[model samples]
Target: MNTQDRLIESTRELLWERGYIGTSPTAIQRRAKAGQGSMYHHFTGKPDLALAAIRRTAEEMRAKAEAQFSVPGTAVERVTAYLRRERDVLKGCPIGRLTQDPDVMADPVLRAPVDETLAWVRERLTSILAEGRERGELDVAMDPRATAATIFAVLQGGYVLARAADSVEPFDQAITGVLGLLTASTPATRE
Candidate 1:
């Protein structure tokens, strides 16, 4: 890859492996194999490069989640597909993990991508639930926005629980529990 691309990519990986405070410009340069001058030439400094990397990660996360939503299925089925999608469970969420970083949370610029990504996921899920209700696939009484938020919370919380326990069991259990709740509430199953 080109110098700028290499630098951006290296920063992305480093940020995922190490939060903003832990990732240093020197480490980025070392990983990218680019000189300091090259890095400065492409960007102002570490924050600028980190912003680029975080934005890229956020975009990728959105695109990946959107793919699951786009598949042909009822809302519950599509949501189930998304929740059950393969992930590096122990690695935690690339974007959600940043929410815990003091530096990332302190800077609005750094936090924008993370916030936007999560909001996007919740909104997308809400849309799906709303559509399902309209189509009678889900119970009419179900609150789309609330259900969406719950589902989003379960996934992020699952990651935290899993990482804290150093096992994927918590994450799997959370998913299973949420899936059960959702599936049981579907109109078809309810009737």
Candidate 2:
């Protein structure tokens, strides 16, 4: 890749591996195999480069979710697909992990993409659930907004649970539990 691209990719990796406070410009330059001049020439400083990296990560997350959301399936099916999508579960979420970083959370610029991306996911899920309810696929009493929030919570929480236990089983079990709850709420079809 080009120098700028290398720098951004390196920053993303470093940010994922180390929080903002832990990722230094020197480390990023070292990882990118680019000198200080190359980095400064392409960007103002560490924050600028980090912002670019974070935004890229957030965009990728959205695109991946959109892949599942746009697929041909019922709301629950699409959601299940998203939940079951391949992921580096042990590595945790790139964006979600940032929320735990004090430096990232303290800075509005760095936090914006993380906040917006998560909100978008929840909103998209809510719309899907609402559509399903309108189609009578989901129960009439189901609250799309609430259910969406629950799904979001379980997905993120699963990542934490799995990481804490150093196993993916907790994450898988959490997903299965949530999926079961969703299935149980599906309206029964007439024979």
- Single out the weakest 10-residue window by summed lDDT for candidate 2: 182-191
Summarize candidate 1's per-residue lDDT along 102-189 as a digit string, tens digits. Answer: 9999999999999999999999999999999999888889999999999999999999999999999999999999989998888778
| Candidate 2 segments exceeding 4 Å error | 189-191
**Residue 11 in candidate 1 has what lDDT?**
94
C-alpha local distance difference test of each model: 0.95, 0.95
* Per-candidate total of colliding backbone pairs: 0, 0
- Per-residue lDDT of 7 in model 2: 98
Angstrom error of the Cα, residue 126, model 2: value is: 0.4
Clashing pairs in 2: none
Q: Count residue pairs with overlapping backbones in model 1.
A: 0
User: What is the Å distance of residue 55 in model 1 from its true position?
Assistant: 0.4
RMSD of 1: 0.8
